[model samples]
Target: MRTRATVAAVSGALALSALAVPAAQADDSAASYPDVAKVREATSVRAEGEPYALNVSFSNVKIAKAVKVGTTGRVSTAVTYTLTHGTDVNIKAADFVTDAFIYRGSDLRPDHRLFGDKPAKCTATSATTADCKGTIEVYPAAHELLNTDAGTWRAAAEATAFNGQDPAGETFDISKVGYKTQANRGTTLVQRASKLTVDASPEPVKKGKPITVTGKLSRANWDRGTYNGYVEQPVKLQFRKKDGDTYTTLKTVKTNATGNLKTTVTATEDGYFRFTFAGTTTTPAATPAGDYVDVR
Candidate 1:
């Protein structure tokens, strides 16, 4: 139910595409252009839902605790759940498709919701129960997410058994379809990927001489499909002796407007220098490989 059946939770328009529009009919409809009323009617199945639909429940819906998305690529996680329905319902029907999705803020926000790129696969364990598996996909290059979009998002599960019905028909009757939706299935985190770098130059240095340490802090920018400097953020400057097993925090420094870091420390013993960021609610913490400098 992906490209054609995947529900796009946006305004009350265009989402009717989620219904049982077959390939041949879908192609013809694309050329003929279906009416606006027919569109809204199709999406209403899961939006407002039918009062007299089939009885099905989504349980043990296990999605990853957090989904991390970086710039310029896709991120996806496997999802599994138990689907229970009345014996009268045919989950094995060719048109039967059910899946879970995650959304944030208002339900009407399209950018806040995410779905699988492909339909879920299910196997029946009993006459009334089936185990379903699927994946939730996110595209950072699509610009569907922003820094503020990171954080907790609500989950929901919906099933639509077309049962040989035309979901996009102007006179479509939802009451005749086997549709079910369970909201607030739980919560999951959507976070931005973070990156850090450190460079301690002037390899061989005289003892007690001033040495320079530099680096940058960056995070995924979904809007630009690239990593951008995270400015005005506190970063720790740490140093470790050549023979030490741990690093000691020397001083806390903040990133410049462009996320660049630069600090001076007196050269003493040979050691490694590194920078670290605690990260924010939206971005994950990053600790890059430490840079080493030799002291005379």
Candidate 2:
């Protein structure tokens, strides 16, 4: 008979003291840090059992096309895999753990730590086969990735089989035979971020008089966690009246160095003026809030 189970992971707790202590009253010595032994145990990766014995393999891996980040929000990618063990072995789904990670640069290390790995949910299809899926999360604001996380990234999948069943003994050995690791050298891109802003001079303007509209275009600079001008790029100037539900494109203006914008239009009615940017392969599109102008 077959049984289903979900392994639960132990949750770690963090403690903080609310009471303020003077610098002189506190222990300033290096001994104040956590014990070296506990730190090593928590940070170090455990050794794996021999893979040849487990005969573990992966197939049918699917990684998302791209990941995007901007001021508005962030994007995550889905990764799936098929896990198979040795012919005679019958491994339960709950006895295995899987993970999917996104890495940057040629070293293929998670050095940037730009993205976080998520645990996989695996279901046993047969005695030797299981299907697993997981996601990699990208955060622009929290991680300060901005445009920096853009470009090609490496995706990897890894799984491990414990010696015993779920909620079992804690002393089992972790080694090669207990683990399987595989990766796809194929690349996925993270698009750059785009931004736009608009304003109209003279809050109240005379009817039929010339009103100047101005704005700027910028994109995230990954290295700096800030935005910089996107020069020589054409942007659309749009307008929508108070009662109108849709905005109509009035004209197109190209950005100059430093991503500055300037244009003029005759005041016809009270409405909003805004700027829109058409994104490129490296950058994602963005539209800023409208600047209201009152006409007398």
Clashes of each: 0, 8
What would the per-residue lDDT of candidate 1 be over residues 1-296, giving only the tens digit for each residue? Answer: 12212234324233323433233223333211123223324555344554256679998888887788897667888888899999878876655667777877655433355766554678889989988887788767766677778888878777766565565567665556665667778788888888899999788999999989999998888767788899999999999999999999999999999989999999999999999898776777888877889999
Candidate 1 weakest ten by summed lDDT = 28-37
lDDT of 2 by residue, 1-296 (tens): 00110111111101111222123222332211112112212222332332333467777777866666654355677877787777654444334445555555443224332322335666778877888776666655554453545677676655544444221235423332244555563456677667788889788999999989888898877666678899999899999997889999999999999999999999999999999998876777779988989999
In candidate 2, how many Å is residue 24 off? 47
Pairs clashing within candidate 1: none
Query: Over 4 Å off in model 1, which ranges?
Result: 1-51, 107-111, 168-172
TM-score for each prediction?
0.78, 0.61
Candidate 1, 147: how far from true, in Å? Answer: 3.5
lDDT of each: 0.72, 0.59
lDDT, candidate 2, residue 201? Answer: 76
